[model samples]
Target: MTKGGMESVELFTSEGKGRGLKAQKEFLPGDVIFAEPAYAAVVFDRTSTWATTTPWGATDLGRCGWKAAIQRGTWGCWLAVADQEPAVPRGAREPMASWLGLEREGSGLAEGCLVSIDDLQNHVESFSEEEKKELRVDVESFLEFWPPQSQQFGIQFISHIFGVISCNGFTLSDQRGLQAVGVGIFPNLCQANHDCWPNCTVIFNNGNHEAVRSMFHTQMRIELRALSKISAGEELSVSYVDFLSLSEERRRQLRKQYYFDCTCEHCQKRIKDDLMLAVKAGESKPSAEAVKEVVQLSKDTLEKINKARMEGLYHEVVKLCRECLKKQEAVLGDTNIYLLRILSIASEVLSYLQMFEEAADYAKRMVDGYLKLYHPNNAQLGMAVMRAGVTHWHAGLIEAGHGLICKAYAILLITHGPSHPITKDLEVMRVQTEMELRMFQQNEFMYYKMREAALKNQKIHVMPEPSNETSPSLFHKKE
Candidate 1:
């Protein structure tokens, strides 16, 4: 894609999928198809209570109304800070038809209560009873904060938008840790359809790692980049859910959260499903029943690990991962997705616990598995390799760590632009690791002495871990 022209992709009506973007020309890995600025971005902050004018408040209105505001694109969103003035209207609001992305010329949809809003994505129909109940709770809560002046717009409009957001809302993340900090809509981003293994990846380019606040929010934009070679006229697609998951699980998430069943090749044909769930069964080979049994067990263990990790039970996460891994390694292939999941979680959790040697081992194994499954320049692969490198570095395996770090740096240079904060940090790590590798080679004894001293003073990081922040203890001066 040309930096200035944004000509690589064009919006087209995709068969089966409605509005979708497609490659207008061939695109190599790393080529950015296009970028879309946030249509309605609101960074949630405790310091600043937000306020927006009635009917269409971007920042001020709570979640549901915020989506409606972005759809209209008329109201200026305001940050309620001391001495800060309320945002004025951008212009006269567009007609309700345009607000809904209706093509009044060909399709008469101006008067209908369609689930698809012009602000974000497609229509959604399914909502579970629990979801309906939760939505009403949200609506009731919204009513508490909603100003009476805007009561003219009936509950039907609010209910309609709540459903719109249920499926289409995008979480905004901070740059450094990729931590969720807010929500926003980039309507054009919705044009890309879903695939299990997409040729393109969406990047939230926030540019800054600082807290999402006034003025800086403008810096947030979404970029769609080719994950690999994409042929001209091929429909551009992205995964709506985690691709690491089994086809059944991935489809379930898509149907429940996104209200669409993925028709991607992997999902339709059960590609990777066997390998992901396969269990070793000696010479006889595992039966489908056997595979299902182990898969269920693995899922249960993983569910526990997730809960433990979220609850900050780092030790329990590590223990459960080890137990699962012991069973998995005995019964599953080395590259089994379930084993990979345990390794991935264990590596990070062990790192948080300051168990660098164990962490490095798990991290290396996880990276090896990822390399087999993911494209060479896959962002997740690059990050996995980078984590493995950092873990090795912390374990004082300078040479091995340096090599992996450099490899990751090269891959990330393509997947994530050098301007990206992650890529920049990896560059720094690469240089630092390279320097240490050289110094260790020059005087191995002094290096170990320094490392031991550094480790003695280093502290284990706590939960809600700071990502990629663990530096080699070589910074501490040896006595």
Candidate 2:
């Protein structure tokens, strides 16, 4: 199972899912397993939907446009670019099957759309009517020009990408003209899977070019094993909470869109199961008593917060978060996931507060908790650590800050490699920190010497005019 720098676990191979990394020992829920940064990424969206066709926007159309791009590099075994002929330019078309959207085949993909690994990995089966309508129109239009395969050895690319989007596509934040900075987390992360009561998470670092992180919980280390059992030889599995819906409708929608099945205990039982688990385990359960106790306060606080935010009372929003934390702690208890909401709010509030130290501390704790609940190497946890370091630097705790930043930089280098944006930033910051520390030390020493001379009645001296080098006293007036 030794691959890359990691000593443990067999990774999935092209010959079949390899007997992936098996845990030699038990790992807690928030323990870190492994993380690899995306080698390279290509962004696409609604306007650029049918990859092979037209409308290659600002994004670089690498190698041979859409389908050919995937085959550029080998990204582990079992994962490969959907098979398609090279797309020649307009007047120079290749004698190949129509490659545009989704298509069916015997065992493998007869024809599949060119998509980012993450998009393909998380494909689902259901979509909203509006999305379906749009997808249908797009597919029909594409098929009108590029028909399907008729023979047994035939290959036809349909429009399943739009269908996939229709079912479970993500809404990217609108970016004007500029390439979207931080959308599209890597697809490899998708294989980690989902859970109703998940023990791992992925998060994006909004500040650092939306760098992704996978954090492990430091506080409660041992509890992680329950979510995933690592035998001497097994693939590490983390919880994916998005697919934890109990309703068949929700499950169907997720499956249709994200393309994964729900076998997690929470999804199997639905709300009733979650409710029972919460009650029996003495954890925070969604019940009449719990809701009744905190509902009013939560409602009132949220209302005020909304009003305050609308009025731009940033401080007031911070106050509300503090109150939320207190109330939630009183009612839901400290370890409850509900507090995550409060912590998230607090992190945002403190980030806005411009109190970097406080903000970083909150971020650190939240990240730690996320790692505990999910996995240490979870993207969300990594983001938290990154945020904490940035915030610490901003807060003037440069020494403390350097330590945190270094940790993030080291991890990012391993997962994302040395060329990632965050890794570069970390290196830059390291240099900057060294310079700052040197300046700070020099200034401190000078200040101390000046003060010492002043207290001792010794005249503070400066360089004399041109003749001062060998002069008896630089501060002496010519007599």
Candidate 3:
């Protein structure tokens, strides 16, 4: 796992996995292995890609990991870039392009196209008969509304392109975690293979934490950063899916989606599976029957919570989460996915509703459980801590809030790196919290009033208007 003298990562062909990237230098947590801009970033343009008059009526096909739309957008990008002359002087991007295996010499999609969709695996054999049938139908549907040039690719070629997109397309999320904007193919980033518990994570760097960006920005790039210390000569791996699921479920998804049987140590050893699916709490184990019932109930409640959130039924979300949490707290372990899910939602909704005290309480639990589940450098844990900190600050627990914010900042420095926009924002929050905490320590009353005024204005924006009319007094004694 350790290479003594190598300086950087290099491309090495794997035994059965064709080609992959490997680190030649040791990477401490938060160290950047390399960065890659999308070989092709297809912005979601409704007008350009769609007929705009479907029965669905102007739907954003590109939003939220829609596969066909990603294909269409990618095909559109190919067409867009294919015919254009080099805007920059010739060979400007060649050296890095050559390093990442991007083609520069040839013309059109077949021969010197930067996109290697033609070479990428479609994983056709991984599909069952029903899934294969569905794929064909999707291909047919895609071709129906596409431009005339799309027809020239024919069913087979188009299907191949679709297969590659299915396999390799990274769903690009704007930093806010609000929505999926589009998909991009980062050829070099794809070189790192999948691991259930990966050493590295792909980060979308746009230089602004609060600003959501479309695909057009120059700063839109993916950085491969270490989540833990990676020794030199080790194969760089990233998790293709999230860590909420059990090893079995995660491996199932890996096989179906990425077409690889995950043999990662985490999957092989079933590491932390007990913690993830624990039904016991402090010498109190629920009966198997009760645990089974509670498990189903938790999933059902989570589904309802998601539905309510999508419908903007914030109050309903709160109610469902509260009920779910109550049931889960008794029967489920603190680290149970369902319980964690409910707590996460409850915290966010309560904070948004300006119920900061309750939000901070839920957030504190969420962060605690998450810390147990995730690596110390995990970004999700960092974000949870940041949210809890902000909630505590708003709730006027300035001391605790400042401590949490500082902790979050330290964690983010590893997961997101100091140069990252989110880390920069966390630094600002840390500084502000430190100053306020000092002020409060110096004179509690003055700082309390100022904090109250700030939190009050925030609540004013979020909360409903107060009733102006006063109630009639019983002492007035109208018969």
- Which lDDT tens digits does candidate 1 get at residues 1-479? 33412466677788888778778888887877777654444454323334322232234333222223322322223222222223211110111212233221222222211213533443424566766676566566555444465444455555655554445546555564344455554555666788878887777665555444423335356677887888999988876665666889989867766767788889899887776665675787766776676768888997887777667787888899888887677677767888887888888888878789999998888887777776577676787798899889988889989999999998876667777778888889999988888889999999899888877797854534733222211001101
Alpha-carbon shift of residue 331 in model 3 (angstroms):
2.1
Candidate 3: clashing pairs of residues: none
Model 3 lDDT tens row, 1-479: 22121136777887666777788877887777776655554433323231111222233322221112211222222112222221221111111121112233221333222335456566766777876786677565554434454344457765655565557767655564434544566656666787767788777776664444333424346778888887878888887777767899989977766778888788889988888887757766788898889899988887777677777888888899888778888888878877887788888888888898998899888888888888677676787798889889878898999999998998888767777777888889899989998999999999988877876686465632211211111011001
* Candidate 2: Cα lDDT at 76: 16
**Root-mean-square deviation of each candidate, in angstroms?**
8.9, 17.0, 12.1
How would you encode candidate 2's per-residue C-alpha lDDT over 1-479 as one tens digit per residue? 11221333333432232222334444443334433333222222334322221222122232232232221112311111223434323211111111211122122322111124323421223445765465455554443334334222221223433332222222222111112221222223433444445443332222234211101100001011223334454445444333312347546744544545666555576743242112213554556676556646665776786677667786877888787767665555333344554565566567766655667767666655554453334433444566677676666666666777776665554333344455567779877766655655678666445545654695533211111011121011101
User: Which ten contiguous residues of candidate 1 have the minimum total lDDT?
Assistant: 470-479
**Predictions in order: lDDT:** 0.62, 0.40, 0.63
Clashes of 3: 0
Error of 2 at 132 (Å): 5.0
Q: What TM-score quantifies how close candidate 1 is to the native fold?
A: 0.76
Which residue ranges in model 1 land beyond 4 Å of their true spot? 1-8, 45-124, 133-144, 151-155, 212-217, 281-297, 303-307, 441-479
